[model samples]
Target: MSRLDARFQIDYPGFRFDVACTVPLEGTTAVFGSSGSGKTTLLRCIAGLTRASSGFLQFDEAVWQDDASGIFLPVDRRRVGVVFQEARLFPHLTVTQNLKYGMKRSAPSPRRIEFDHVSALLQLEPLFQRRVSHLSGGEQQRVAMGRALLTNPQLLLMDEPLASLDRQRKKEIIPFLQRLNQEFRIPVLYVSHDLHEILQLANHMVLLKEGRVVATGPIQDVFARLDLPELVESNVVGAILETRIAEHEPHFGLTRVEFLGQSLFLPQQALPPGAPLRVQILSRDVSLAVGAPLATSSVLNALEATIAEVSESPGDPYAVEVKLDVGCPLLAMITRKSFHQLRLRPGQKVHASFKAVALN
Candidate 1:
């Protein structure tokens, strides 16, 4: 059962935003698209501030609104937390006071979470006495996160929460969000147009275009899919592969990520074997070859796989999806004309060539 379910149709001036999707109870679902794509609008509708002229909104098995008969819950009663692009803390308040504001706001009584848990998760102990205006951009974001989580909401919505911060600040705050998701099991809808953000944190993706939802699913399967070119190569479509560090070759400063226990080397920081790590392999980085090459200068991440399918549209790149017996999959996009030249077909064994730079 999903912890979040929502659908809405809203109009603002000449633009209309229509969205519908259910996200899993765990991990984050990145609502992605261009600035004008209405991703944020859809998020606002779910938050109950930008009421859709009509539709249904449900969270954690409770009906927030249903249109068959008129029913709408005010934002205050929705039990949903929101974190904005800017940390909108009260300037007069200290970090402790700001967080207490939400904790004190919970109805009936504050419940399910403690201020200490959120503080520890976000590393907030050091800033407890600091006024909101005195903190760094990243610290402010963390404080904002603590404020929201302390409320014990059924769902959390973040609308480009990192957009206002510089790259260094954004990088610092990412690990905290990942921890918040896992430690609390909070289902979050993170709206963003940034490719790097989506690749690192999202387990699922919901793509919006001109106010309508064009695609939604697990990041791995969705990245393996075709036709969302607007997203695939452009926004860095890919998945987070979890692997054990097989070994570290000290001389090369290289580490290997194992898929089904086979080691493939890539130059990376040293990590102990049996320690878990993640890798993001992009689609554009992948090139296909018919079989194992006898000799080549390319340090390709060679593996044996049967072509599960080959899709070559007129004038479109000859994109192929290969399935390895190792239980991991790779997606590659090549020129369609190259497909004809190579005489590639389904069920054929092929080498999926990729470079270290391609591994994000």
Candidate 2:
């Protein structure tokens, strides 16, 4: 299992950034934090775009930077592809020319990412002859991504690539970004403050706060902790479930996904059966009952779960966070009133219920 080992210490007049973590070099790992939390700074350090005052960074077996040994690889020598918030395309060049420019700068004996394959992967064929200045925000971003892919990079660095786009444009580019990792097998360091984007794309996460590492691990494990106030404060605390499409019910306009011997119904998805899917159920969306729920209820999901842990919700005297084990771990946020009413405790059995639509 290849991994990225990083340790950085940077100082400015009024800010200090000190972070260290070992991130797996597989799938997408999100560098998540609020604005000014040093998410972009960490990314730039990895990309060799910004030098760390004193640091060490190693990708797998390659030591890109080691100040102790006076070894530091510059940006171009790193074979990293960077996509910024803006497309930053050449106004005078057509999309093909811009894409080819990246291809021409490929690293020696690089993993081959063919120009046609990149064009088709990013759906850039139609706009090949069109000037980048004439393209829409989403189209331009897609072209930018295609150009980056053609560079045959060892790793892809995206710094809020969708931040400048409107909601619809973000939606337009997300699927392509999702496919980039799956198809190219390129490790990605995705930096963003958007929890929704992180939920949708990241398998592993490195959480930052005040320029320091707050949490780091598989998304499921990190979110399951329920002890991080940053997440609780954001009011988006949840569990991430990795499931597979079991079947589709066209008559009911629903798709069934299976995980841990349990099934959940979601609004119809286009992916074929057996495809892997990641589902997020927010803590606030889950409800608990002392016994098995009745079939007469309107709520769509009711799973038998055991109370694994319970703790006071940070900054909320009236709320409590409950950890449940329904084959897979789940987090539920309930009022302190309900906590007393239910007599909840670790090792107690309970049923977790939530509406099917809540997952949407």
Candidate 3:
């Protein structure tokens, strides 16, 4: 199996970075953390742009670095393509020229991505003749991505490529990123602090904190951890569920999705039946009940669940996290007042319900 594995130990005057993780060389892998958390440092190390004094880095069967043996591959020697926060296109060149500049760097081997293929993949055909300065932020980023893909790289390193874009622009470019990930099947190491981006694009995740690896695994498994929201210092607490469209209820503007051994009703989606989708449900959106709530309630999902674990919520002195085993683990955030009133405890049975709209 193809994989990117690395273990690094870097020391500074007052800080030290100790990290080790492995990510599959397929689909996108997100390196997530807040600023000053060494996310970029880790990306640089993987790309061979920054050397780890004591480390081992390997891609599939090729070793990029091994300190014990005094081996380290330089950036140019590694078949890696990097995209930064900003689209560093040449101001004087047209989009076509910039893309060609990237293609020129290719070592002339049989290429998997061609100019026409990338142009179509990124929808860049019409923007080819336009100067880089004239395009929108989203357009420029798309071109940057197209340029990177033109290289036919073994690995792609993107460091917050959407950070410079506004909300609208980020929204505009996401589908293109998704398309590229699916079309090229390139191994990508994407770095970002934005949980939204990771939830949408990442299949595997590596969570970092203060220059250390906190967790690394499938995105759904990592996100479902009861302590993750506190560890990342963000309220992006949620569960990622991979489900299929089982049926549509047009009269009610609802869609039925099946997962594990149960089904859920969500806002109507235009997708055909049997289409796979990944849904995210925030913990705050879920409410717990000692018994089944009335059918008259607006909640559409009320599944029977057993308490897996209960823990105090950090930063919120009045709230607690309740992990529920409803076929799959689901997290619910409840106030201390409610917890005490309901007499909730571990190993107890309860009902987990949330509105259909909460299934995003």
Candidate 4:
């Protein structure tokens, strides 16, 4: 069953976020757009903190809003849990105490979440007695996540939850977030403008432009159809793939992931087989050759594909986007110099390859 049925419109000074969309009742749905693009505002509306001018909001068949009947639930009354950009844990409260607040509120909840499950999923056992103020930025965020889970909500909303942290902190928290999604089977509505995070975390994308939804679909199809890459940001160029951890190789310090029939040796942390994973491969990092080359190079992940289409890229070094068919389309950004070097043209057979570290 679909997890969410929602729509809303909000007016701000010279800005309007009139969004109408449907999200899966499972997995993470990303509300992705640039800053001041109404990502946060949309999340607020869902939480019942920001009232919509007129719309409908439902969670798993429960009606939170229906303008026709003027049905509106207060923020506190709605069975929704929200974790904001800032880890707003009570400074005076210990981690355990802060977590307890949400659990106690859910005591009367008809569908309450177990404390042990929440603690285990978020790795909160080690910091149970530590004061909120004493924890690092990442640890505090972990605690905040635990608090939200303890609420036992039907849906989860996250508004740029990792925005306030540095790169290291973001890395530390993402794994936990993914674990929460799988462990609890909670539907998440995540809002963000960071493409890397979006590619890594979300399975569904709701592309917003000027406060209106421009496209929505499985991320791959949406990207293939999206012509305006400028709407996003620089360094926001890549594609996502579903990969599974394969058996390990002791000789080489690399982890293999089954990409299709081929096993891609990626510079990822090793894991056991059958573990499902997602990987991001950057477009710029991809290099193209006219045919499979017998070269002496460490670069791996070579795929045979035909150039289906090409487009002009904006930069000092002129570039073009090449479409490759490894079942799905793969994007490669090649310089004008190299394009002329290979005498590359459309409908030409070519090989695309890149380094393992470039996978990120």
Q: What Cα-based lDDT does every candidate model obtain?
A: 0.75, 0.86, 0.87, 0.78
Model 3: CA > 4 A from native: 108-111, 356-360
Off by over 4 Å in 1: 107-111, 231-240, 270-272, 293-300, 312-329, 335-338, 356-360
- Backbone clash numbers for all candidates listed: 1, 0, 0, 1
Q: Superposing all C-alpha atoms, what RMSD in Å does each candidate have to the true structure?
A: 3.0, 1.7, 2.1, 2.7
Q: How well does each candidate superpose onto the true structure, as a TM-score? A: 0.88, 0.96, 0.93, 0.89
lDDT (tens digit, per residue) of candidate 4 on 151-194: 89778889898999999989888888888888888888899988
Q: What lDDT tens digits, residue by residue, belong to model 2 across residues 77-165?
A: 88888898889998888888898887887765636988888888889999988878789988988988888888888889999999999
Quantify how close model 3 is to the true structure by its C-alpha RMSD in Å. Answer: 2.1
Least accurate 10 contiguous residues by lDDT in model 3: 351-360
Model 4 / residue 197 / CA error / Å: 2.0
Candidate 1, 1-360: lDDT as tens digits? 665777888777898777888777678999988889988888888888887888898777788888867889889988879999888988988899999998898865434887788888899999998878889988999999999998898788999999999998888888888778888887888999997887777889898888888888887666665556655336234234666777777777677778666566678655567876667666566666776654754564766666666554323444443333225556666666667778878777877666533122
lDDT of 4: 0.78
Model 3: per-residue lDDT, tens digit, 280-360? 778888899897678788777877899999989887999988888887788888898999999999999998887533222
Query: Can you tell me which runs of candidate 2 are displaced by over 4 Å?
Result: 356-360
For candidate 2, what is the TM-score?
Answer: 0.96
